[model samples]
Target: MKQDSTLVFIPSNLIYKQTGYLKGCKKCFENSEVYYVTSNKPIRNTYQYQCIGFVGETVDFKDSIGNIPLFINSKNGQLSVENNSSITQILYDYDRFKNSDLIHNQSEKYGQHFKYLSEKLKTTREISQNGRNSITKYILFLVQIFDYILKITRRIHQIVQKSSTFAHFEGNITTAKWFLTTLMEERKITPKVGNTICAKIIDLVIGVILTTYLFEYEQQIFDFINFNTEVIISNLRGLLLYLMGQPIGLKLNYSYNNFLGRFFLYHISLWRIFLQGLYPLFTGYFKFLVLPGFLGFSYQIAMISDVVSIATFHSYCIYIYAARLFNLQLKCLKSLWRVLIGRKFNPLRDRVDSCQYSQDQLFIGTLSFTILFFLLPTTMMYYVVFTVFRLITLTVYKCLHIVRNTMQTIPIYLLFLWIVNASSMAGNIHIAWKSFDDRGNVKIEAKLEKLPLLESVKKFIPESESPAKNPRGFGEIFHSILTGTIL
Candidate 1:
């Protein structure tokens, strides 16, 4: 199947009954042909019929599709898999299961765009409808079972305390807030770790691993990419400057050269396959890594926080998380946002039209141009600088016997960093803000409250009234302080 057209296995009898079916059918199809799969002939004249097959529960196909199972359900009228959700629907529901490999690959490989997902499903379907084995079938079965078990537990808990957040008031922001708070409080304790220690441990492990691995080989990684790609990076920058109307003979400043030199050297594609792939792989987990660190580090503060502190911290966390998501969405919305916000009615319309618009464009274009020329040389350079700086300082201290041993030095610094972070310096530079954000709300303090009046007041207060200030230039953008709806 070269995908000359769409492959539809519509019910044979209804093909001729064109109830905008043709429209949905035609738009998707690359070619005019529609393959029909049915057990019986059409009741009326068929538009196109190429395949004949019976789709039932115990039956399997010979076509070599991907290992994932696909089945047609006559009962629900869904193209489903293993009696779960519809195949088409699940494929459409990106990130429903964040841990899923298929979902992860969708973002990394295909940018998780609708067109890409749709095309992928179409191609995979037409490629081959190979029958999967009992092994895959069993694994899916277990997943479904676990999902069912979780759902049942949640449902049971819902009965004890109402599932609805604001049970009386249908749906609103207040209701949503209450419900979410309830959910977090309801199951505050879990089997393995009390106080969400698992999240903390994970953060510690990842931080240690990142620090050690990156610190040790930082120079090596830098040099390897730099020495090999220097000429190409230089020549490429010169070319870019020329294209931008800058003379080729113009002397480049250290800043300009540094910026260009780092771009290509940071790229993963130029490296051995395994290494390059790791960058995005690491990036995609940015939130995961960050959240754990923030939550874990600030965990104790949360337990002791007063009404205002608690409300602010929780609300801020949600805001930051949501902002992070918004940022991610913004990345995807580039060209799309330009057209959308260009509309006068759009919320960000003014921001879109401002003089900063060109600056933003230039910034994006420059960054893209850098990436286009070379992968991530700038990123690697920054990382190596940090690593070297930390290592050199530690080395000097140790050589002077001021820092006696690795165990004493590292732990002492780490603890000092923790204290500094917990003391609110974390809210400044270096993602210690993440740790600070995790300080739990003491207002709730393991108690479930129906009306968090104080929290509500805390939520609505103007930013100017709040004494807290973030030095980070982009803090306002990332730190969300929702006005109301505190629970």
Candidate 2:
């Protein structure tokens, strides 16, 4: 019988070990049979075997070689044998067949692994986008809340100002007390009510709490915007330092005033004694009459002193409050500027560099105007104080003419008044300067533009015009009414 050609098929497994033999197998044999080999290597487990054709005819040497059939039968009840027709061709085919199952299996496994990884990456991206959207929504909500609070405060201020009569004051105080008591009750704290003084104390307490909440809310909004705790903390420290410096400067001015007042009193007392000794000799026992005149003169001086003191105190208080308000305004402006420009701490350079047209002129114009406003007002006030001091000195000399006997003592009253006014002025100036340094004007400008009613008011009143001066007495009165306690 004619021998049939051997055929071979290489399994994927063991492909790497048989690259040279694979080339030989394709060249030497037209058709050859092949079988894949298994190994203990972990990587080889996913591979499988393949057969191209029959290897050879079955060979049964009963006692010796027939054990192959038995071995196959023992394992899986199947016969396993190679053809014998083309022995030489079959041997070559078997030697040259390449195993490729390992490469195929590895490719499929990695493809699945990459597919899972891609899915996870897409999911992560979606979660991040959602978080960003939520943050944006939260910021918008905070801005709305801020707007509402501003409107409420403005309305309250107007109402308080319009109703200034004693009855109105008492009514407001009563309302404040009720509001505070209700708030306390809501918090499960016992409520207390008393006279005007007590009410003011409560008002102060409530105001402080409200202020704290406002600050906390602002901080949260800031955190959302920046999203870095260290940056937020640094900015907060700057704000706190600016605030702390205000009271220190105020106290220093107060101390200076007291020293001046004491110096004036000492000189004045000496002058009085000297004048009394001189007066008796001028009109024989008229010195006794001069005592009564001295007493009346002292009363007039006391009244003048009281008026000056009260006015100075009121002015100083207003200045301090205005300074504080200005500081807060500047901080807000800085925040807004950062939002608009997409940069922080480079207001001048960044803003200016971005300017492309005349529309951008507004920033420079506003900055120039602010600087002028602050400098002009401060300069005018300084000159005015200087003129006032000159006039007071002239008045003191005129008073000395009538009471030449007490000429030495008149300087004491003048000095006391001068000291009080000077101290108060110094304190106010310090506060205003600090506030300006803190960039308050920028904030106020931003707020005025943002707020609806405020913007309307600004339209009617030019930007050059200042707001009505706040009453100094109102702080103490309001504090007492709100908190129900006296300081």
Residue 99 local lDDT, model 1 = 11
Tens-place lDDT per residue, model 2, 55-168, is 122324354221221111222222232433322111111111111001111234123322232232223221234465566566556555555654564568665433212222
Candidate 1 ranges with C-alpha deviation above 4 Å: 1-3, 7-53, 56-197, 200-468, 474-487
Q: RMSD of candidate 1 to the true fold?
A: 30.1
TM-score of 1: 0.16
lDDT of 2 at 328: 47
Give me the displacement of residue 72 in model 1, in angstroms. 9.9
Per-model lDDT: 0.31, 0.31
Error of 1 at 395 (Å): 22
